[model samples]
Target: MKHVLLALDESDDRAVAQAETVRDLFDTEHTTAHLLHDFTDNFEGASVGQIAAVRHAANILEDAGIAVEYHETSGSPSTSIIEAADELDVDAITIAGRERSKAGKVLFGSVSQEVILGTDRPVLVCSRRTEE
Candidate 1:
């Protein structure tokens, strides 16, 4: 079975939309979806490495009959995702990308961009286009 790591930020609505897209694209019967969240800081009531944004995405995959797993870790978001993918030996890493201005990207390096640059594994970026 193909193993896919879905890199998600639980607080982002775009991640929810990306989850739906991932569910539709992969074959549930033949694929395993791993939901991953990189927590950079401690939040109240959260154990270290516990994901706050998994249920909605997990529900979508589970309802489709796809095997699902969750992985949460604390670190640089891109680095954490790369480490998880390497450790899991996932076939691909999927992430939701949002448009950022050149200035924004220069100031704040993008996690998706870092993951793509740091790893040789195929990265699938699901982008949400914003209406102007």
Candidate 2:
């Protein structure tokens, strides 16, 4: 895989870390990971906190000899992730899942769910937020 987009959120270290693990498993060079924090304004402003998460992931992956680059974009986390993955022509996507309350799921539609349903590329989901 040339590019792998890893979906992340502000309090979601679990998911970002899992995404990096998938990148390692693939042994893909030229790996680029995109994290979409949030969208601001009416398509004009954006708040992408995933940049830090991406950098954190890159450090882990790079130490293992995997090349990594990360991008922070703005928009609905799910929408931004899919768009970025498509833009990058990602071969696959890795995502970490955290527990979401009923309200959280309702408001966000669950990022992991959205990425799995929306993308043509393979998505590796790690269910760890509640995993033992």
Candidate 3:
């Protein structure tokens, strides 16, 4: 049995939609859906990593018949996400993929890229146009 973490953020329509999508992508029985959110003291107050957001996303995963363990962590988004994956020793990680704008890419760098390059585990990046 392997654990699969469904990384979530404040993105739109994640509730049932994203959870079900992940459930179908990975086996729920042999897998545990781990949801992690990071809340940091950014200039805009506490953000996606907040415990409340993680709790909200966890509820959605549960509704989809996926057994999930969720956590709210403090730290950089990519760093903490990788740490969570390491802690669980999951077989893989499933995260939403976004098309990075040139400017955005240059400034903040890429979270997905960072995670993908930093970890040895295979990362399944979910995108609308991506093929299973």
Candidate 4:
């Protein structure tokens, strides 16, 4: 079975939407997904919101017959995602990319871009689809 690391943000609708899109496009009955969230705060792992978000994502994958695991960490998002992918020995890393203005992107680095550049494994970046 292939293992996929699904990176998420607990509160962002765009993140959630991208994750759903990733599930729809890539998940299979035999795939195992690790739902991961990274926090900047160095507190206890897995906040309530993070757990809820993971569960939310998990439901989608589980309903599709994919096994799911929840992982949480405190650190740089891109670094944490890469670490989780390596530790879990995932076959690929999936992340949601939000639309950002060029100036915004330049001011604040993109975690997705960093992950794509930093990891040797395959990275699947799903763009946040706009609502009609």
Score every model by TM-score: 0.81, 0.68, 0.71, 0.79
Clashing pairs in 2: 15-96
Scored by lDDT, the top model is: 1
Return the top candidate by TM-score: 1
Q: Quote the positional error of residue 107 for candidate 1 in Å.
A: 12
Residue lDDT tens for model 4, 63-130: 77877777778878999999999999999888876667977665334787789889999988766566
* Runs off by more than 4 Å, candidate 4: 42-50, 102-109
Q: lDDT at 40 for candidate 1?
A: 81
Worst 10 residues of 2 by lDDT: 40-49
Per-model root-mean-square deviation over C-alphas: 3.2, 4.5, 4.7, 2.9
Error of 2 at 66 (Å): 1.6
Question: Residue by residue across 54-110, what tens digits does model 2's lDDT show?
Answer: 556656666666655546665577888888888878887777666678777554347
**TM-score-better candidate, 1 vs 2:** 1
lDDT of 4: 0.76
Judge candidate 4 at residue 65 and give its lDDT: 80
**Model 1 lDDT, residue 113, Cα:** 76
- Best first by lDDT, ranked: 1, 4, 3, 2
**Residue pair clashes in candidate 4:** none
